[model samples]
Target: MLTNKSSSSSARLTFWLGLVGLPIGIVAGFLAGASPLLLCLALIVGAALLWFFTSFEQAVIGLLILRSSLDLFSGLQLPSAFAIGINALTILYVVVALLTGKAVHTDKFWWFFVGWVMMQSLWVILLPLGGLGMGAAFLPSAIKVWMRYFSWLMIYLLVMQLKDRVPPEKLVSLLLLSLVAPISVALMQIFLPASILPSLLTAQAKAGSNVSGTLGFPNGLGIFLTMFIALIWWKLSTSQKRLPWMILLGLVSFVFVRTGYFTGIGAVFLLILFINSTKITPIRVIGVVLFCSAFVYMFGSTEFGQQRLTEIYQTPLLNPNIDISRAIILSYGDGNSFNWRLAHWNYLIEAWKQFPILGYGLDSSPVLGIKDFRTGSGFAPHNDYLRFLVEQGIVGLLGFVLFLTVQGVHLVNLLRSSPPKSDRRNLCLLLLALFVANLASMLSSNIVDATTFFLYWWTLVAIAGWGNEYWQTHRLTQSA
Candidate 1:
């Protein structure tokens, strides 16, 4: 009787505490205003509390959701919220883990990865003392640029630490869940009234009927949806409930096609080829042929698709009737976005000739006033490879290449060694497909600039590495 009374008293006390604290917290938030620093502080505190109470897997899922859906909160004018919240949570999690003696042990692969990242950071830090001095005015921009690149390193470390804590299946589920909001918002944009939708979530007029979805640009949306198609395709292959996944795949693919981004389409086609490389059976070949035929028929029939194809083959400069000057002017105008990219690539090559070793430093293109043909103004090179070549130079470029090569090798090994029907093997195949898709997308689009896609890419890379190590160790233990 006494125990029951005590339990009831405790429950009442907890209920009262929640009732009082909820309003107090709301009032405090309002009183604090929406200053970036204050908002960051509140987010950090809330995230820290969440990290402490929840499993690391849950925290990771929440972080990914925030990273992906940040554009939804742009109306609040808190552009830095996503970066600040992510970095704070990551730092806090690392600090807590270290203090509690739960720090993840590293292997040689991690050491090499960290060393390469540090080398890039060292070059960026010494930039002011080197070629172009970093001005105080440009310091913040440089830091933000550095942070954008460095966050991938932090993501890798976080995933490595949680490798043992979270199961692979759980991680996959969380990733799919994180994608839900962005995909839903993208779908809603097609049907919702323009006035009801956030401006950033809707397609811009300049995109020429291509939908940008929540990414604010057609190319960004293309990269994201293409990756989703690859992932969902793999899921459908393995899942018992195929209908739902097929529906999602169709929706995302339709939106992606509507974006009119050729790179994404090419990437998906390449992924399909890769998936069927080992199987050349008659039925498989027929299926592949039919799929390609149907896709081509649908795409070629669309007005935007017809226009894009015409632009590719019919350059105004190639016309014999136009004078040289008139041809140049016409080719550089609004109708020739592809020609603009070619011009930007040419400019980047010339810039690379100046500082071929350790280029102008991170984020130096805007600072140094690199000419962008796209807008006849200054902007970073649209090509990621070109950006690296101009910003970090040959050493940085090589290091990045090595990082990618190592990941590819690891994934291939994992796929070859794992059982064909195992979950891990399917995941490896999916990651490889996504990697190839993004690589193709990066040729013309700045793949890294899309925060959600970039984060998703690196997270998959880290998870693949962690899983490879886990399975290898398990095999060894079994043999012993």
Candidate 2:
């Protein structure tokens, strides 16, 4: 009855929202003096509302639209506007929840809380040291990084508090919805003329090509796609529903090649096959074979596709020239690039021989010319772990490793105690996928993209604790 009441209330809310939205949209169209396209969009919204009778987070969408408009006026970019809108909505949601006394912290809050406290405390400690200017050069970039971290941290608190507010089905739905926008952008890129394709691609290179989709980072885009692919595969293999998800999966895979990160495709196939084989039937086996065949046909045909596979195959085996081979591999077999990462690692190890204790203060490496060793570019090591070793010395790296070790150990214990059939399994799978992706990313990128890194990291921390929360909830319900 309560469920129905909520549904009915939600339906009524949608009706009123649409009823109000139509005229307000018209007023907006006239007052703002937007283009005909904007006018048509407003009309389309009204039509969609009338036809579908659907309820959406109208307030949030309106906020995003307003932000985009503001950005257009200010000559700021679209992605920046989108990011601002997300941050604004996320913070507003958390604040409102807290004010309404609905928010609660998770058991894992201590991990995130401590991590935040440490970062803040370290910043205070490093302020007088003046070493932070080295690697973290620009004031805007540095502040933006911290702001991203803090925004995601707050988002973590919201998720931890509202775990019950989102059901498994809802979670699945949200994940699917998130894919729609990106998938659309990716498809547009795929279908666009060769002349226009370059303009569409974001700055980040997925397969050493400028084909980044909606996400700024190519690897980030791939990682996000892999997450959805995992979810779809899970649902297709486990749930009775298959056709809808299977079609969606196919569509996603096709657009996936737009980035040309074949590794992501390979990872998806391997993980899906591994999970599906646990209960593999004749039909399932045939499905896997068909998917793999399609993947190969589509991906292997492209120049970027052929190059990635070639690189993987040509990745030099260990020999007396292993360092030389590695340098070639990192630079995509280019001998002229100088590949400073190796030299960066060598410099850090050599420096550790001196002040291994506290070493240089945070962000102090560039000041000492750590980056000037090989490339003359004065860049940090591409590898996050190596960067940690360089900047923090042996002690700081160990501290970071210890932090990760604790998280890993805790996850293992939680998974071991969790029943196989429980929803906690999803949490475990998601975390495991994220962990693997982070690990893979760090081998080549920086810690800024890794396990302990961004908003997603904090969100995962809260998610890791959800298993125990759900278990407790289940036990109480059973008792009742």
Clashes of each: 0, 0
Candidate 2 lowest-lDDT run of ten: 471-480
Pairs that collide, model 2:
none
Q: After TM-score superposition, what is the CA distance of residue 458 in candidate 2 from its true location, in Å?
A: 4.9
Error of 1 at 299 (Å): 3.7
Which candidate number has the best lDDT? 1
- Model 2, 1-480: lDDT tens per residue? 977866765676666667867989678769458577777776776575443222224433333223212211223455444455456655655554444343345565456555753663453355355643233344444454445555555556545654665453444445355565566666655566545555435334433343545665555566556666766765554445668878988887776665665546756666666555445577777878998899888788877777666555433333334465466456533522234445455666676566565555454454443444366655545566765565566666777677666766666666666666455554555556556555565655554542112434454456556665454223111100
The TM-scores, one per candidate, come to 0.79, 0.66
> Candidate 1: which pairs clash?
none
lDDT of 1 by residue, 57-113 (tens): 776767776666665555674536666656666777666555444446454556776
lDDT of 1: 0.67
Query: Can you tell me which runs of candidate 1 are displaced by over 4 Å?
Result: 1-53, 72-79, 103-108, 133-137, 193-196, 203-208, 315-330, 366-377, 468-480
lDDT for predicted candidate 2 compared with the true structure: 0.54
In candidate 1, clashing pairs total 0
